[model samples]
Target: MITPTITSLLNAKAFESLVQSRRSVRKFDRSVSVPEEAIHRSLQCALLSPNSSNMQLWHFTWVKSPEVRARMVPLCLGQNAAKTASHLVVFQTRIDLWRRHARWNLEQTPPSSGSESDKRRMQLMRKYYSVLMPLAYRTDPFGLNTLVRKLGSFLLGLTRPVMRLGGRGWQRVLLHKSCGLAAQTFMLAMQAEGYDTCPMEGFDAVRVKKLLGLPAGSEICMIVAVGKGTPAGVYGDRKRLPLEDVVSIV
Candidate 1:
């Protein structure tokens, strides 16, 4: 076990303040351009966010060109966030790259020295990437993989707890969940860097994909507009349910 140090405690307080200061600012100060370094550093922080199985199926598209930003504004339904932002970041999930990532993870495993525990660990790592990952991500035209997953889950769950697996919908949800976590980390990092962000789900994903030239298996998670926020950008006082109302103790 580890104990929190004074520095860690202070950092926690700072993090709380940062979270409190963050807001979904719809209007940005166009006159004040966001530093390129800030966006770059924030994206780097986002890349370190926790993801399922470390597959890292996410991608970020930074729209800095004025022409592309202009094209994306209408794609985002002409939202003020897109219209005024100095930069727009598109978060995407590329489920199509799963196999490549899995193979990469396998390749990253180091060779074991002469030890039973080390050898067993290496074997488990290899099997996890080679066998389990393929089973989890593979699909077919006739829905055969989905059928097998459902049947296996039902049979195993009858005797012990098992993860219920499904078709493309489930896979998409898994990738999006990981991508959303990365997006949150990016927003927090931006806030720490004295910037504001608005995550917009209101957009024509089809058109945005075409504009960005994203492949078929790529899905847009959200479009985040970033810049210096104006006072008028915040809609109103932040509202949330009371802690007791939302939390439950067993």
Candidate 2:
């Protein structure tokens, strides 16, 4: 039998415990206010999440003001979870940030006078723009799918994979995956901090956009509620498909 590596053991011990312990909390005690420090700490964990090219495309807002929660909870299709939770985190994915990052890559040509490390940095920036240029300037780009997405995928059909590797139309999907990962990282990190979380999907997007003052192209993905757990009016018994039925390893 082969022995497990030390790194693998450490990773399993650190992450697996957190994953197993997390639950989608529905019942939150209405009276208790979540500590601002705890919220900040959980967000700090999210800051450490892996992002594409270190682009860090995710933005978060903690909605705790009574007026905002009152208005926002109705947006969640009347889900009391939003109205009652101690805090609601609004996850916004801005497409312009990726473009900004790409632009930075272009503007920040490494000075020719820095260390060897600086020379490598400039080379990397040039390489980054080389890939993002086609993506940034492509006509009829995005297919209007997402306002923002993966860098290389936007250049697909115009660029050859074996030749330069555009990875086809996987950009939008990849962006969604990256953003989703950030969202989950935030939620699970909250769990790790011993706070209960409820991820909500039912909501009025148009109204939410109006409420948030978002421009024409932005879309709301989901809302996450955090607080202490309770029993009354809480979402009951979550049923999921069995792992045997849901997972298939080839």
Candidate 3:
């Protein structure tokens, strides 16, 4: 087993501070520049985020070209965050690569040790990526696959709990959930690197997709603008519902 470092054990307060200090910075200091290494490290940390079934049906596009960045500003509705930021990272979901990813996962299964238990475990892992993944992701122009999944779920759930499956809409939601987790991780990592970010959802999706040349099966989750934030970027003090109102212990 891996050993935990002393830094990890004593970093709880540091982590809390990091979370508290992070803000949705709307304006960036144009004179200040963020290092390329900071963005590289933050993206690396984002890759380690938890995802559904380890399929990793996500992609990050770092817009470093000045030409593209200028074009993206209007696409992002001419937001100040996009206009003044040093970098813009686009988070996207690639549901069309499910088959390739599933096969890759199956290939990663360890070879059996000839023991019955090991053999069975390998068999299950193989089936999970090969058979079950297809069952979850496959779609057709007609609604036949969706109908079959609904019927199967209903019949199986009568006796035991089963996952409710749907068509493309459900698949998109699942991928977006995973992509959102990565985006949060990226933002936190950027904060740790002494930078600021603004996750912007106010964008023309169709035009952005066309500009980025994204495939039809791919969907943008969010675009995060990163830079050295100005003091005025923080609009006001943070506000939220009291813990008693928002939290429940059962």
Q: Pick the TM-score winner.
A: 1
Per-residue CA lDDT of candidate 3, range 1-250, in tens? 7676888766977899999999999999999889999999999999999999999999999998879999999999999999999999999999999999999998898888999999999989988998889998999889888888889999999999989988878889999999999999999999999999999999999999999999998899999999999999988999989999999999
Q: Which scores higher on TM-score, 2 or 3?
A: 3
Q: List pairs with backbone clashes in candidate 1.
A: none
List pairs with backbone clashes in candidate 3: none
What would the per-residue lDDT of candidate 1 be over residues 15-41, giving only the tens digit for each residue?
999999999999999999999999999
Range of the 10 consecutive residues with the lowest summed lDDT in candidate 1: 105-114
- What lDDT score goes with residue 144 in model 2? 40
Q: Order of all candidates by TM-score, from best down to worst?
A: 1, 3, 2
Q: Please report the TM-score between candidate 2 and the true structure.
A: 0.74
Which residue runs of candidate 2 sit more than 4 Å off their true CA positions?
A: 1-14, 104-121, 133-171, 231-239
Please give the TM-score that candidate 3 achieves against the real structure: 0.95
Better of 1 and 2 by TM-score: 1
TM-score on alpha carbons, each prediction? 0.97, 0.74, 0.95
